[model samples]
Target: MASLAVSLGLRAADPLTNLVGIPNYAPAYLAFHFVWAYGILSSRTLKQWYKLDHQESPRYDLVKYGEAAVKSGKITKRQLNMMQRCESASANSVENYTFFLGAIGFATFSGVDRQTVNYWGLMYTAARIAYGAAYVLIEDRKVALVRGLLWWAGNAACFALLWAAGGKLNA
Candidate 1:
């Protein structure tokens, strides 16, 4: 599996091994890229549905069109909620990408180990995927626990990154 290869490759590389400017976190980066792309693509479903339903003026503003669709009986409450969750997931992914960028900047400036960043980044990426899926697809109360678990995993990864980053700060 590609992930297996990436994990193996990552394990082989030492965080202490310098890569000119930063340690090679390519495996983590690759996973980040894949997850980010999926987030972007996931948002399109709502747009496509809105456009198909509103041929007269297909352009959508979530606030306006979303409410309109539900009111007009064009989409059910559940569908609208799912679409909103998907769109929110996309936005959260962008925020996560920003966090990655910020961490890399902080790590490089502080001389933090690339291995630390890479492993933590990978964890965050995987957790994000699970959290996003739970956010968008599941509506049942019984399954809320699944989402919570994913959220905790992602949150823990984020905390790990922060801790790693803290280790290298000039303070």
Candidate 2:
């Protein structure tokens, strides 16, 4: 009975898990999945921009090809810079996606509150989207700090979820 409860994260003593609303894991998992898919598709779309410019089989390497294009006057520096921002934003999203996925999964398995997990998952998704938009749109270096704040917000949520999971598992 104890093993089954642990495996299913169904500790009868944990009041938070018995919440009336948003107490399932599926919705949180879907939120994470949507962000991951968005990152991959965004990166691919940036690559397609390069393809449009090159027309005849551009190199797959974004950094090298972008630099070469800028040096060779094939593309303007501003264009390369914009592409770099988009690519970096996509890359950041993908990187964070890995950590968020594990954090939420472990938290769920450890019997952390499903409502809390859902809130973290949804908030993290929104933060990543805002981070990407800020990264691309904010030109002023000082004002661009908003992107860093958004990134930290998402990471903080993951850390909080992981911490909660750890505490619950130890108990």
Q: Which runs in model 2 stand beyond 4 Å of their true positions?
A: 1-16, 19-41, 50-75
Instruction: Tell me how candidate 2 scores on lDDT.
Output: 0.72
Model 2 residue 6 CA deviation in Å:
22
TM-score of 1: 0.64
Per-residue lDDT of 75 in model 1? 77
lDDT of 2 by residue, 32-58 (tens): 556654654364566576553444543
lDDT of 1 by residue, 1-171 (tens): 534554676434334543324445745575665566464536665667665334454335556678787788877888888877777767666656656566555654566677677777778777877888788898887986798888778768767767776886745
The Cα error of candidate 2 at residue 27, in Å, is 6.3
TM-score of every candidate: 0.64, 0.70
